[model samples]
Target: MNTSSDDASSTSESVSDNDSDNVPVIKKSKASTSAGLLSEHNKDNNEEESINSMHRNHPPSVTLEDMITDICFHPKLDTIGIASITGDVFMYKYNNEETNLVSTMELHLKACRDIEFSEDGQKLFSTGKDLCIAITDVETEKLVRLYEKVHEQPIYTMTIINEHVFVTGDDDGVVKLWDLRQKGSEPIFSIKEVEDYISAMITNTDAKYLACTSGDCLTTINIPERKLHLQSEDHGDELTCLGLFKMESKLLTASNKGKMYVYNWGEFGLHSDEFPNATKKAINCMIPVTENVVITGGEDGIIRAISLFPYRHLGIVGQHNFSVETLDINNDGTLIASSSHDNDINFWNVQYFESLNVTEPQKGGKRKWLEHNLPSSKIHNRSDFFAEL
Candidate 1:
């Protein structure tokens, strides 16, 4: 494996000049294995060829300013929204080779931290460092409403709870629940438990619980009960990202310390022995490709695939020129998109992703972790596991 310092060298290689033409074969070099990841000599010749083939198959990236903070795909359309630190939101129609700007809106006065589309993809919601939340009509490209000073500090994280409700977390470690119908400056509900910045928040499949993470602890709140469920002790690392697995029965949090902690849902005090030293570098973002499989982007600028049940490294999927700031998958799971603290957002093709999501894991096969007290009823559908909504 190459060291992380060499990851950006891979991006120096030019993409194919012809957008319509097939990607030319990549000559093996330090650039081929960005960040000194897997070397061609380490895998079977055919497997190495396949990995290179996939790398060559990726679409050209969308370039933007370093101010770009977040990107989200429209639920039902071929549209993408780019939010930037400069407080501008740009909409683009993305084809395989090119991204055409559809519209641009300057709504926030400061950095736009995060953005999400409503369930129908008709309305877009965004939060900003300006302490405001803005809703835009996707079809008309008009600002529907703006909630100013919604939080005391800069809002950094957000999650769509459901059609009628959404959630936001700010730098002050405050979490607020908002109702779309209310459209008020004040939130419908608010909670302040963690003393540091809110790094990430996630709602379960049923929206029965919401999990919030900071530099050290993970806090769970019961939605219906509107009360604290559990607060885990500090993991001694900044929890940068979180994901759920095993039918949402397990919670995994990745830290800046290059470790991933796995906990049984609702039991937050200890980590399961299933995952240890999940990655060598600090992970910034993660998305589940399947119930038992996930892809993570780290401080090293390399993106890797990992298996959950037995905690094995699948392999590296791709790399970025800088640390990956965020990750998103389309509704069909055919494409995985990642954004960095730079001007580029890269797209990768997930071959057979649909088929893989639908098929059940083979029993008594190579994955011994699936055989441990695994119950038949515990199986969850692909959408439920990813919790895209």
Candidate 2:
């Protein structure tokens, strides 16, 4: 793997210079007296504390009112949709000047665990603990259709396959494929793998392959073929989420055991050889920033920037007071939005993301990093960050 593009050292170099200059320096005389030793020790402790405080990530960009279970960004706009535990789904339009609530709907009686916008960005579909799936019109801000009791158990996750199709996973380890053209509540196709509750379902941009995870095992399905493509060995821990990268060449699954399994997409039916321990606590959610870098949100409430090859912790982006529940990057890959169990959502500016890591899948593949306009310098001051929020 080409891990040495723009080393993470560049990011540290940019921030470290400004930080080291701010630390208070202490001078000690060459005296061998106990008083002199005591003074040096105290000075060392103070410096350590100051350095940690300086490196610590800042607070959230906006604090929501309910515990967020899921979040999704619009494909072509500066809009974000968040589903909360209190049956609230909020759509907000955010820019540098303001974060405005575009629409608010209480579409479910219980927690709405997942919400995804259609490819056209004109409609939204959500499934939740109420065992119902609802479709809403984005422009009208009205309920378009409701599929009641679509699953026998609570629906934990959902993914939009295309403009007309989507998939939903229930707590009973069932995966159901839905079609918008159908009027009935029944799924067009369903798959039952194991008894363990289905924790997550992820797909590549093409939506050709679907990967599902449960407490004990991982499975990948070929969507068009409608057959199982791979089933990994029992991980011995509850898997919470999965991420895909490099044109879907790599697959990563995270567990409640604090371990992550990496699989090569080409070796579909084989066991994964790489297992990276990202945290000692559960990694509840993760999103790939590039082919080699991924950001994870853990039960410790910290969002970590981690590199896959020569795996290492880069640093933290932001934090929460409770377990981070979900993470999403906007379609353009310029912003990262994270939600936590503490009822808050944080937005991070990723202007220098491409410079700090490798985004190209193949060594000589057409580089897409320069497609977007990255700011000349990243915004550092938190006061300048959430001013209008």
State each model's C-alpha RMSD to the native.
11.2, 11.9
What is candidate 2's lDDT per residue for 1-389, written digit by digit as tens? 00001111111111222243223334444659999888877876887577545433222255565556778988888899987767778988887546788889888998887888888888888886889999998889899999999899888788888878899888788998888899788888889887877778878777778888877688878888777777878878888888887678888888777888887874656545555564568888898887778877788866777677756555566556666777888888867887654555677666466787443343222222111212211223333233333
User: Whole-model Cα lDDT per candidate?
Assistant: 0.70, 0.70
**lDDT, residue 231, model 1:** 88
lDDT per residue as tens, model 1, 45-96:
5553564444445445787743468888888987778887677889888766
Point out where model 2 deviates above 4 Å.
1-60, 357-389
TM-score for each of the candidates: 0.77, 0.75
**Candidate 1: residue 101 Cα off by (Å):** 1.5
